[model samples]
Target: MTAVNSSDEIAPSRMLHRLTVLIVCLVWPLIWVGGLVTTYDAGMSVPDWPGTYGYNLFLYPYKTWLFGPFDLFIEHGHRLLGAVVGFVAIGIVIAAFWKENRRWVRWLCVALLLMVIAQGALGGVRVVLSDRTLAMVHGCFGPAFFAICVILAVVTGRRWRQDSDAERLRSSTSILTPTKKLAALAISLVVLSYVQLLLGAMMRHVQPTTSAGHFAGIVSTHILTAFFLWAMTGLVWLRLRRCGDLTLSRPGGILIFLVAVQIALGIGTWVVNYGWPSFMTWVPGSQSFLVQAKGFVDSMIVTGHVATGSLILAVSAMLCVRLFHRRWQAKQDRLVAT
Candidate 1:
């Protein structure tokens, strides 16, 4: 067997990395559009799967789609954006297989491709079945797909494969002594964030037919989980900062900032969607206030909250991957030295 240098085997391809970055950029907006669809209650606007009003997705009349009702506009636009992301995922898979040498990287791209296909299918099935529960599952799946895009971008970037700082850090076990604990915390945050997002999705997808008590229970749990997620993410950021690793600290800081913004947006979403809860309405004998449903401000705030939650999840996942990569590399270095 020919012995290939590990460094040579994993040589980074700038083009492939750029392609992955493009997919990430495209998928981020796809997630936002998906959120908007849920926010406006427009998931069933088209009333068909993989098509718009019996026309092929791409063949839908541009004029009607553009000048149609608000629900149709966002719903169709969401489909259009999803198609673009799907195409981009295909490109990533092809590029990875052709231009990238790392076996794991190639297979990860294939996994991404599969995930995109599954997500699209899930959306289509939700529409055809007219199932709100399926819609909630579809909503939860979008962020997971987006997180995979982030992972692909991070692993393929020059920073991941060739950064001198990363190399040095990987060689010095002493410097990474706290990384195990920090990485564990980061992973925990990622899991907690996903759970919170699932709860939020349940709240968003609750049908008008659902019981008031059921809705209230989901909302209460979601609100309480928000505070827990905020505190846990904050602690992770603080610990990462103390560790003094820029790679970890930078994303950690971004996660913390995003969590803060998400909390504000969460409040705004509640106010815009269901009026202020009685506890927060300050005026004497004043009822809670709600922005008009599907209004501009309401949609934007609710969609932004959903989008930011995905961003926080992506950042936490990235940080966890980087930390684990360094730890693995450091272990390998110690073995080689011994």
Candidate 2:
């Protein structure tokens, strides 16, 4: 790798990759705190837009927010983190346009910036109107933004460049055939995982008019989607492992693991929100299960569940891109050979 780096290759900007990584790191905690905001129902805690309690967000007195009610702390903190993310995103766009050589990747950075702005607008609008539906949209969109940041980070990394070289080398060797199934399966997982996350968000942000029957139907759908998503992740991993390509296989394994962890977290979240199901009343511990409202364990479990869903989305996206890169490289290698 050092040899490659020191060679005639046109290297990407180290500073830009670092900023890309910086934004990726920033978005995760933003998502976590955003999750915390929803878990604690703190979206309206501050009760003002573009500012907290009528004070500029950065100028909001630390004495008030830091030592204020838990909801205030989390909500104000979420805004603070969001502002930081926006700044970093702006920085990424500047760096990308100024230094990034690839035209499409530069456009990707622009898309990422637009997403950040739109996500911020969604959050502000959710607060100003106090709309649960928009809150749910805000919640669902955070993961999607996080997914984009994760992809951008991977694309800008040194490892990504190395992978391209590896792909070209593999294509030259002609040791492996192209995989239409992997590409199709990967894209399918990307879409399905996102849909599952959306359903999960709707379940969390139930409206007042949502009756027991409707909510139960949602629960049923969520559980069924989880099962199918789990199976798809497993199949993606199997396909990648069979190809013996670590770049794709590692993320494939990670994707399936995140899905498994997400399933367990979903169960934990259900237990926290609704207690053990009524059907389990005959079981030992089921009789004693009491759902805690806003308890410590409850918040972490629910927040973790949301964060894990974002991770599943990110890893699945990574797998899809790498598989495409491999296939494209294979095609190029065949053309060169002929």
Candidate 3:
């Protein structure tokens, strides 16, 4: 196998790379929660952007912090977390610029960093303009940014760049056209997940208050898109299972399981609570069976759903990267043998 060597002086797989990946993965969930904080109209709970109560970020007033209300604090905390994510993104991008093997990979990281900055600005715009449209667009971009980070992490991981020509030639000998097909299905599932995420952002922006036809349309569209996401995930899993590639197939199986649980929680929240509270929680202070069901559905459910989406996307991309690297190795081997 031809090693994927860098012309640059620095290498990416050092301890810093792993740390960066870990940080990005951890930040992804916070990004989604930030989206929710805005989607639920909680952005102005503190009546500020980028800061709270005239203090910068972490230095907000203690009284305001501990007041008889928690909405502002939640929003402020989201902003603070976003700032941390931004710093981590910048660091990772700079690391890529100096250390990555491939020139294209460096450029990709640069583009993603720029997008992150733009996303941060959009958050400010969403606040200053008080425009739901801007808020919705910002919310939608958050997941895309998170997905990019996930891709970066996957690329930096051990299994990503390490391809074996010997194994590839062996794999190729097994009539693994089915494996290629599974790779395609994995790519499709990732794309569909992004689409579903966008639809969800749109629904959040609409925040339908009444049982009007428009609200029902939004709800129906959201639910149906979710179903499509689930179906696409199933296709990914099925193709991977048939491919018989244990590495790719195993991760695909885990992703499918995550999707199943995510969909169940989604259904429970929507069908039982009509998607109230806008926070993925049960109706507050209610003891009814419906509220109880919603509460059970709420805790960890939304977080799990978003987190799982990011995970599935990361896993799918990793599988594809493996396939392409293996193909490159195989082609190289055949030339050497000839």
Cα RMSD for candidates in order: 2.9, 3.6, 5.2
Best by TM-score: 2
Question: Which candidate do you rate higher for TM-score, 1 or 2?
Answer: 2
Q: What tens digits encode model 3's per-residue C-alpha lDDT throughout 22-76? A: 6676666676567457534577776666667668877877677667365575677
lDDT of 3: 0.64
312-334, model 2: which lDDT tens digit per residue? 88888877877887776566545
Ranking by lDDT: 2, 1, 3
Instruction: Tell me the tens digit of each residue's lDDT in model 1 across 28-94.
Output: 8888888888878889888987878889999999999999898899899989998988888888888
Q: Considering TM-score, where higher is better, how would the candidates rank from best to worst? A: 2, 1, 3
Show pairs that collide, candidate 2.
Answer: none
- Residue 71 displacement (Å), model 2: 0.6
Evaluated at residue 221, the lDDT of candidate 1 is 88
- Flag the better candidate by TM-score, 1 or 3: 1
* Error in Å for residue 21 of model 3: 1.7
Regions of candidate 2 where Cα sits further than 4 Å from its true position:
1-9, 166-178
Count clashing residue pairs per candidate: 0, 0, 0
